[model samples]
Target: MPIVHHRKPSLLSFPMWLGTRVLLRPTLSLWPLNKAGMAGLFLIDRAFAAGPKPSGVVRERMTLDGRPVELIMPSGPSRRDSETAILYLHGGAFVVCGLGSHRSMASRLSKETGLPVFSLEYRQLPQFGVGTSVADAVGAYRELVGERGYRRVIVAGDSAGGFLAGKVVEAAAQEGLPRPVAFVGISPMLDLDVGTNPDRSSRSDAYIPQNKVRELTPLLDRGPVPLQGTRRIRELADDAFPPTVVITAEGELLEPDAIALVETLDDADVDAVAHSYSWQVHAFPVLTARHPETLHAIEVTAAFIAQAIREAKDADDRKDQRAG
Candidate 1:
């Protein structure tokens, strides 16, 4: 696993520190993990998302195979990445946060990568578990890369969406779909079993309870795994997966999970890198505000995706030349 450590606890972290540990931690740890609870959060998130959105991006609401999605692109005359696009899945623990909620990050990604970003509003828990959400995501990805005619697609997400991103990479291969050129996960929870195990570096950190995750893992996704005899997500990655970049907040609940996932990808001979900041909250990259570290993470993610696509394109060109 290639781990890059970043130091300096910026003053920006103080608010996140207070928000995560002081506010979010207790609330998340005690909240009822039921439909009503999810609904309440959804309402709250909906209001927040309904507020001011990002500027300089054209956001269009549309549906792909009956799934609601938002297509975000740069406002002015811009050049596309040329047959390459991003299928972005937003993080919200598979419950709250929708297109409006995640529009900022998606729009920023569009601006940064010079590619259209399709932010899918997948089904979530209380009605649909992780399996159903994964199904929706995979279907959207297929539509984009198959009929939609994107030659190279990258699946990227944050938090729970990151988990879905991983699942999309795994399921795409099982369905014989073209492999994504790259995968980007920020504070992704790759393994539901992450909550178990006392060895987790920072199990006590914000927004995720070590014990709660273990108990809630089965409820999150009880459907059959795409791979036979393999129940955990970490077992899904193989050589078929493209290069991956994961950003984790050190001392947060998902840091160890990110480390373990990078290790898994590395062991599978997949190029993987993890960037960690010591003083940040889980999934902070999605903030998309004036945060320095968040901006840095997004920059790194875009660079990785661009480089991966270039390599993939080069390989394709080489093969075509040989065939001709």
Candidate 2:
């Protein structure tokens, strides 16, 4: 008999869907506006974010290579002998959002994984560009893995932060730094050239306007030409990348980017997997309260991290046995 797979229904039911369409989508539609307009929207988000914060974690403020970062630790007992840690990068279109705004997600991740999460507050555009953000992220990774003696690191990020996570790994490969054991990209904005496809504009999530890609392209571009022309993952060697998980929402505009990234990684012979939701919002895993799909995604991510670390250790044990 042929195998039959049964997929679970989404938690993004009628009420949440209606709320996204009515309130969230309209607010995100203003992302492509002028600086003052964007600032106003950001301020509004900040104002509304004054509610109770997530608990079950301890937050420690610190500076890594001059950039501010928060180290989040699960409140209960955790693996003490493991040198593995997670480096989390927050997403804000390379323009907005920061450590404070993304604390809830970071804390939740820490609680679920029972691992320390170092959330980096990388600099953004208008004052910084792709180069600076990548630099900050790489610097933080070095501080944690290189200087701090972390043997295994899982690099994870959301949206624009997802892009940064990939870039940092690629940069580390070029610089001969130790590779991360795994990578988790949540609703990543992988391709800056996504705007070239006019059809994608219509398919984008209601919250993310297609034109916003064009508007932010120039600001994020650091090369002589545009960022669209720059080589992203193609520059890495076949074995340079680690196992990766790319998550996306089918309704999101950047779903194509996530699919393309997974395909690219597969072509390079890297272990890459793509998990998609049929009706969730972009970066749904970062929702303030854990949605059913969000919980499922987080569980998937935690499992991937655990499996990757275990596999690496097993491989090392085999190598040691051979040496002996």
Model 1 lDDT per residue over 124-223, tens place = 7667777778888888998988888888999998888887788788777878988899999988877656666667745547566666676567677644
Alpha-carbon RMSD of each model: 2.3, 3.6
- Please tell me which predicted candidate would have the highest lDDT against the true structure: 1
TM-scores for candidates 1 onward, in order: 0.92, 0.87
RMSD of 1: 2.3
Index of the highest-TM-score prediction: 1
Please report the TM-score between candidate 2 and the true structure: 0.87
Which segments of model 1 are wrong by more than 4 Å?
A: 201-204, 222-231
- Please give the CA lDDT of all the candidate structures: 0.80, 0.74
lDDT, candidate 2, 75-172, per-residue tens: 86666436888999988787887877788888888888888899998876655677778778888998887778988889999988987788878767
Which regions of candidate 2 are displaced past 4 Å?
A: 1-8, 31-33, 38-49, 202-204, 222-231, 234-237, 318-324
lDDT for model 2: 0.74
